[model samples]
Target: MKIYALLFLVLCLSQQLHAKEIDVYAFCDASTKFLKKLSVLPLEDLVAVKSAIAASSSLEELSVASGVPYIDWIEDTQKQLLVSESDAKLIVFEQVKPIEFSRYSRVINMHGVKDHRLWDKVLNDCVSVNLAALID
Candidate 1:
């Protein structure tokens, strides 16, 4: 029993030490302008953003929409990543306001209109670069 307990503790400690850290960024729209803006970001920043997004739990969004218990989870996850609400970037093409957890760095209202051309441009760019493949 003692050896079993020691082995379990060692395994747990090793896993924690090897855990990957992630960074979170909030984006409103997928547009060329937004993509261009992101292109200037440091490679580390981009990696962190991707890691955070990939690790993010969809349950949080569901909880937000359903009025469920997500605050604790969000807070805990953000804490783990050392990201504050102010540090999170919110990028969007529309005039939509940023949410509580994010800060808007650039917002192009475009008269409340959305341009699919820009959207498609961004999507095509993403596909060409295989950005989705990097998420996991």
Candidate 2:
């Protein structure tokens, strides 16, 4: 029994160590060239992406860096690359978030909007169509 417990602990530790790390992508439109370009972003670019995560960074920075105003979030869900909005909108893995978003980003970009009412609505209603969780 002790041996079994030890084995279980070891397995858990190994799994934790080997867990897949999430990757970040910003999209402005659905374009193969854009997807391919993002897939091969340099280490510096990767750092930029990492910094641009929600609350930690802004998509504007990514836009300035990449010359694209749109962004998308992509992750591996159930062995398939799932692309989705933070609001749980499902998009093709290669699809880019629209620059002229009427919902979240627009409000976010608006002057004196002050409250994240629009963003909160989308976030509260977020539901994954392909994945178990929306934000992971």
Candidate 3:
């Protein structure tokens, strides 16, 4: 009985240890980039991104922002609608279901990797909107 219980515990722990990374963070990041390039985005999206960034004090974000006014403004204003969905539950592989990411983050590339070929495929399969067409 003791061995069976221990084995069960080990299996449970192993499963959790190997749980897949949630797409939420990746989705958020991609959405941020996509929205920034757009000339227009919903007010709610801007709110969410701003809220997330505001709530964080990471040196990485600070350094990434640099000192450009337009860049800073873009970072804040592009994520308005995406904010409302920020409270939704983050799903895992076991919960596979069609996800309608926020309008700001409508496009997603599921090919990101953390292995040796990572640099070769940064945003490899991500969608690229035509900013020129939208502006016209």
Candidate 4:
């Protein structure tokens, strides 16, 4: 009926209002301290960890390997929150497209992190474990 339709629309709008998103570029800039430290290492050493990252079966495993705790990464990006799912989807598409990243590990390593100074909130904490795995 008309009333049910109205209620459904209202619910959808409310969910959209509560939805959140992160800007990939901005997030990369925030940078985790752990990842910043890794950036200082020789590229070969960093590349050497690729196997460990790939072997990890879960985020917790990757977190342990990298010494970065697992947290709700996207939600933690308070600076780049987006209410619209469409915008978030577009951003994700732009960053992950043109090439296939079947695994999370591959995607995380391809995008170098940002952040030089060891700040209060390390990019490692706010990012997905896959990215953090490359830190150590």
Off by over 4 Å in 4: 1-26, 32-37, 71-136
Per-residue error (Å), model 1, residue 84: 29
Every candidate's lDDT: 0.34, 0.30, 0.29, 0.37
Worst window of 10 by summed lDDT in candidate 1: 89-98
lDDT of 4 by residue, 3-69 (tens): 2223222222323433133232244444333345555565565554555555555545455544544
Question: Of the candidates shown, which would achieve the greatest TM-score relative to the real structure?
Answer: 4
Report the number of backbone clashes for model 3.
9
State the lDDT at 112 in candidate 3.
27
lDDT tens per residue, model 2, 1-136 = 1222232222223233332331111111122123333444454544444344322234444345435434222222212323234422233111222221222232233323334574333233322211122132
lDDT of 3 by residue, 9-106 (tens): 22223233222432323433464454344314455654554444444343244323222122322232234214322221121111111111222133
Per-residue lDDT of model 1, residues 55-112, tens digit only:
4445443334323343443444345446663332111101111121121121221222
lDDT at residue 129 of model 2 (Cα atoms):
15
After superposition on all CA atoms, what RMSD does each candidate show versus the true structure? 17.3, 17.7, 19.6, 15.7
Lowest lDDT block of 10, candidate 4: 95-104
Comparing 3 with 4 on TM-score, the higher-scoring candidate is 4
**Candidate 3 deviant stretches above 4 angstroms:** 1-39, 61-136
Among residues 3 or more apart in sequence or in different chains, the pairs in candidate 2 whose N, CA or C atoms overlap within 3 Å are: 26-71, 26-72, 27-70, 27-71, 27-72, 28-70
| Candidate 1: pairs in clash | none
What's the distance in Å from true for residue 111, model 4? 12
TM-score of each: 0.25, 0.22, 0.18, 0.31
